[model samples]
Target: MKKISIIILLFSCFVYGQNKQLLYNFTDIPQSLLSNPGAEVNYKWHVGIPLLSHIHANAGASGTSVYDLFADNGIDFNEKLRRVVYSMNKNDFFTVNQQLEIFSGGFAIGPSYEKNKYLSFGLYQEMDLHLYFPKDYAVLAYEGNRDNIGRVFDLSDLNAKGELISVLHVGLTTKLNKKWTYGFRGKIYSSLLNFKSTNNKGSFVTQEGTNNFYYHTFDLDLAFQTSGFASLVDLENEGQNDWNGKAIKELRKRVLFGGNLGLGLDVGFTYHPKEQWTVTGSIQDLGFIHHTKDVETYTLKGEYTFEGVNPLFPNNGSGQTADEYWQEIEDTFDDLFELDTITKNYTSWRSPKLNGSVSYKYGKKVLKECNCTAEDGDYLNEVGLQIYAIGRPRRPQTAVTAFYYRRLFSFLSGKVTYTADTFSKTNIGLGISSHIGNVNFYIMADNLLEYQNLAKANYASVQLGFNYIFPATKK
Candidate 1:
């Protein structure tokens, strides 16, 4: 029972962390193109260094951390688990998101050197999960209803979604003028696995009754769903004996475009109101997938009421056996709450995200000896604020970050950020980009201060990539 409770809590604690706040609008790195396709880049062409091009991972939890569960203090494990569960709220959550790039590259596509149009394309794999804390369900599971006589357990606390998909994308960016640049990206999503359950209703309650000392009532409407994983598990007997080497090989084949398919779009623009002020915005993942293969759905919808059972032998012969009495009760309960499992095709929409930022450049002008088209060029220092939001099952999660950027030398640039969000209020991040001749590299990390003791940290992320760039020839 404790093992089951732990699994439920782990699944219920998920939250999304794909904001990539530090990398937004950092134009030196080509991976920034994924966040905002309209980002301005002065290079003529660029190519990612194969598999090492871009790698990212982010994880966060609202009410608890890894230290609470694994710390080597002299305390009972069950007691610590109870304390953590009780400290969390129904709205608190945990989330994880990760991406790996296979290959990416971009180049100029116009006839004239003066033309400012560019094309970019790439392929990557991603996995993401979001789950709200199931506080009511946890209480009911851990401590049975023997002590609480009138309290009710809510069923709506069950809400979670997760997905694994591979994406193929192409984009085009064109400068309308010296002050404005616009871009659009087309995406094809191949979903490998997906699961979601939300919008549940009903509850369970116990009270004193006229016919008996206690009466219990259960009114539940619950559903669980899955796609691309039904064939790997033995649902009939709730077993995994068939999940062997052959099963894994078949699953691997579906990771490509061999599963469900969908389409999405991302549109963005960068505007320079003046020479010193810049603004940018973008919307991403506006799409849906149709699950027409390997689908499984389970549903339970019914209401049942039970009073104390009557005594079989009232001070007469032998009393009813405990096993027989409990067996009868179980049969009656099963009949009341009819369970159904079926295979049905369905469609699900991707969680759309919105990003916007504004920045002002100041300080001394930087000189570019290689490509000198103007007397004054990029600035040595800048400051900016960024806003991000993503759609969720209950509401949209939002975050705000303020950052300062600096160019220490001709080949080194970096940015520092402070952010406030649902997971934590003290998220600090750093990003650095370096160029040695034609080769460019960048690395970014969020919540850096918490790395000192990872057990107490609520959120952490890191991203790194490499690219080869070519400068435009002097006319």
Candidate 2:
């Protein structure tokens, strides 16, 4: 009974390629190369499950979990929300990313698999959204500036990024000798829509005034940029009532090669100094996109101060009335916030990620005298620690995972992980791969402890795929 329970616990699968600690260097799955281009795999050729080849979704909040505000602890809901907001700082953030493969395949080259090169190619669509916690903005909206006198709200706190894109990629890996293997992947990216608003500077403040009233000050500079959404704006301007099919048409035009495009490169290597020890490292998405079509940038700059609104009754005909006074105030604000719009080409760099791990193998699997299976030369168990980092606007996001991998049979294998990162202190993950005949099916998941009751989870992710692997045939 205890052994069965352990099996069930280690079988809930998940992947975080964005930091995919489970999938990195996990050589059994061909798609593992997405996380580490230089990954090691034993297949001579393979075909993916078309659209079902790979499916991944991840979302996490660093500030707090959902249960913190929605718990059934008999506390006031609003009070709970307030506590959550207060407990968090501006550096905290929420992020989400999802990917789906359209198609993928790979094949080995040369005389023999062990002494040659392998090539893999595929296409996938992905979307990502990232945002930092705006504590000052929340306070301003919740209590208004009236309650917090002389407080400054920094406009720079508003940092965010979002994008939807499709990537076409091809990779090649070669073994130079028994001790070294290297690989690299080339990618072309097509973006359907994207937006960024990370660079900003200014402050909003409410202070006691000299005119026997409160003074609201706005010394502001802000900018927002977007690409590939010009058609929607035109639809609204044209007053078109029917937007169903037309919207889809616009999307189709951009999702293909007609959209904003970019290039990326991924490279890595695997090394073994001793028979039982291995080390691997890789960098992914070192590239940028050019946004030239349907591009727009909006900027708000300059300064303005308001003591208060005034009611005016002019005795002279040249002066504004109470309503005109309001109009005059409106005009002042209009000039103060005169917006500048531009349509110019800009380059946006893809956020690059880093992965590295060191592992040692032991407990050789009991095998037949003559080696005939793929698992023959492999060990029964492995233990290792991996590190992951990704570049961000404000800083780099990082995590460390320690894992244990076991191969109970030639057809079934699994890995269990314990991770610590900005998202949570205690995150447990599991991944399983099964090979029956030439077909392979894999699934991985993490944070199962919190998954028991999702509201308590600050992070959640899952990855799964199917493929057909063929044995290497020597020339």
Q: Count the backbone clashes (under 3 Å) in each candidate.
A: 4, 6
- Return the TM-score for each candidate structure: 0.89, 0.88
Worst ten in a row by lDDT for model 1: 234-243
Model 2 poorest 10 in a row by lDDT: 8-17
Estimate, for each residue in 395-416, the C-alpha lDDT of model 1 and write its tens digit: 8989999999998877889999
lDDT of each: 0.82, 0.81
RMSD of each: 4.2, 7.3
Query: Which digits, one per residue and each the tens of the lDDT, describe model 2 over residues 218-330?
Result: 88888888887765667543335467567667776776687899999999988888978889999999998899988998888878888865545577555657788777778
For model 2, what is the error of residue 296's alpha carbon versus the real structure, in angstroms, after optimal superposition? 2.0
Residue 22 Cα positional deviation in candidate 2, in Å, after optimal superposition = 0.9
Cα lDDT, model 2, residue 353: 92
